[model samples]
Target: MLIATWNVNSVKQRLEHVLRFLDEARPDVLCLQELKATDEAVPALEIEAKGYNLAVHGQKAFNGVAILSRFPLSDIRRGLPGDPEDIQSRYIEALVSAPSGRVARVASIYLPNGNPTGTDKYSYKLRWMERLAGHAAGLLRLEEPLVLAGDYNVIPDARDVSNPEAWVEDALFRPETRSAFRRLLGLGLTEAVRACDDKPGLYTFWDYQAGAWQKNKGIRIDHLLLSPQAADRLTGTEIHRHTRSWDKPSDHVPVSVTLDI
Candidate 1:
């Protein structure tokens, strides 16, 4: 099955572009982050008209996430389980039952940006990462085929960013943030893209300002992490660079991975 993740930036503003991409790409399952809409405002009917079932967890004017799938989806839950007080439209998960009867529990997450270090928001970002690690560890113990995909808002490494020095003080590249990210990945979860390609310039997001996309300056923050079972089935991984060139495009583009079980 082809499973893809994208941070659409804003679902309402980029509805047409998203629709166009869906029609063209036709992935078996699509995960979205940064929807920046509310549940009542979600374009569910429009998306359903496209012949895919939808699961959405949205907030107002900021973070949100959704999952669209052609396959049967079940056991859906909104929000991360570790923190009840943490209010952010950042997570959604569901079980996709494939034709072969294999069920893969998948989550689409948008991690905290935590810009301007030494602030409460920055501390929240680190705390969020800790929660994610706790959840990921529990999921690994389940030993089920699981995939966590989305915009992690982390630079990951010097190679993942276009300008390493420029992002040293940025929340995405801070030592604490990077270490937390690495710890999450170390929980017996495989990063699908890195498993296939280690190239330095494989980025999924660029800033809307500073001519980042125009100058091909970007960062790799979006990711697809898989459980052992899912990792074993990974066949291909790709970043749709062309999407950035589309009309009314999001600063972030889609990243997809194919799997055969």
Candidate 2:
């Protein structure tokens, strides 16, 4: 099974890019983040026409996520379980079975991007990560093939960013933020791309400002994390870098994993 993730920025505006991707990549499943639109606002028919069943969790003009799969989806989860007051449409999960009857639980995540250092927004980001950690710990016990994919908005390490010095004061690169991310991996979840390739320039996102893309100033914020069972079946990982060059394309590109399910 081939599963992929991309932060389309806005599904409505990126409909053409999304459709083109579905046709070209043909991944069995795709987890999308940063919809920036309501579920009703998403161009569902256009995507469904490409043979995908979608589970979307969206809010108005803000965070949103979706899971599109070729196979039937069950046990669809629309929101993260740890917080009831938290209403951001940032997480969604579903279970899909490969033709061989193997099932994998997949999630689309748009982790908070806490900008500035000492504010509620920053605090919320940490709290959200903690909630995710608590929830993820529970999922790990299922012992099934689970894939948590999305735009984590985390620059994992100095190697992940083109200019570490430039991001030192940024919330995404803060020590606390990085530590929370490591906690997830410490739970035995294997980062699919890193497991296959450790090359430094393997970035998944580039900013549109200040000639970042032209200078190849990018970061590996987007990720596909696999549970032990899923990691075992992993065959390869790909970062569709060329997608960034497409007309009015998303800052982030599609990252995929091919597994021998």
Candidate 3:
């Protein structure tokens, strides 16, 4: 089975790109971030028409997420637990039952992009990270295979981003954010892409401004972190850079990991 994660930026604007990637990559499951669309506007029927099950958690115009899978998705849940006041549609999880009827939990998350990191948004980002750590702890106890994949927004290390210096003041690069990520990963989870790839220059997101994609300046903020059961079955990983080359493409590309469980 192939599991992939992509930050589509805006599903409404990049619906074509999503369809194209689906046809090309044919991942068994695809997690999306930054949908920027309301649930009613998610084009679910169009996606289902393409032979996939769909689930979306979206708000008005920002920080939405969704999951598309060739297999059936059950026990769908929207938003991360632990905060009733948290209204952002940034986290969605479901149980994907494959052809063999074996089910695995998968989550598509979009961590906050707390830019100019000295305000309430930054604080919210930190708090959100804490909530995620707590949520991950619960998943760890499930014993079933769990795959948490998404645009974490926090760069794990200098190797994950092209220029460590340029992002010094960025929220995504803050030591606190990275430490939060480490704490989450400390829940006995493994980053599938990092586990399979040995090189550093492989990035998933490039800024549209400053000709970042053209200049090949990018960051691997989007990721697939797997539980022990899921990681043990990892077969291959690919960063589909060609998707970023498409016309009016999203700023981020898709990263896929194949598993042979």
lDDT of 1 by residue, 143-178 (tens): 888899999999888999989999999999999999
> Ten-residue segment with the worst summed lDDT in candidate 3?
252-261
Candidate 2: worst-modelled 10 consecutive residues by lDDT: 193-202
Model 1: colliding residue pairs? none
Residue 117 in candidate 1, Cα distance off native in Å: 0.7
Per-residue lDDT of 27 in model 2: 95
* Cα displacement (Å) at residue 256, model 1: 0.5
TM-score of model 3 vs. true structure: 0.98
lDDT of 3 by residue, 177-216 (tens): 8998999889899988889887889898999899899888
What does the lDDT read for residue 23 in candidate 1?
A: 96
Tens-digit per-residue lDDT, 177-249, candidate 2: 9999999899989999889998798799999899999999999999999999999999999999999999999
Better of 1 and 2 by TM-score: 2
TM-score of each: 0.98, 0.99, 0.98
| Candidate 3 pairs with clashing backbones | none
* lDDT measured at residue 198 in model 2 versus the true structure, 0 to 100: 83
lDDT, residue 178, model 3 = 91
lDDT of each: 0.91, 0.93, 0.90
What does the lDDT come to for candidate 2? 0.93
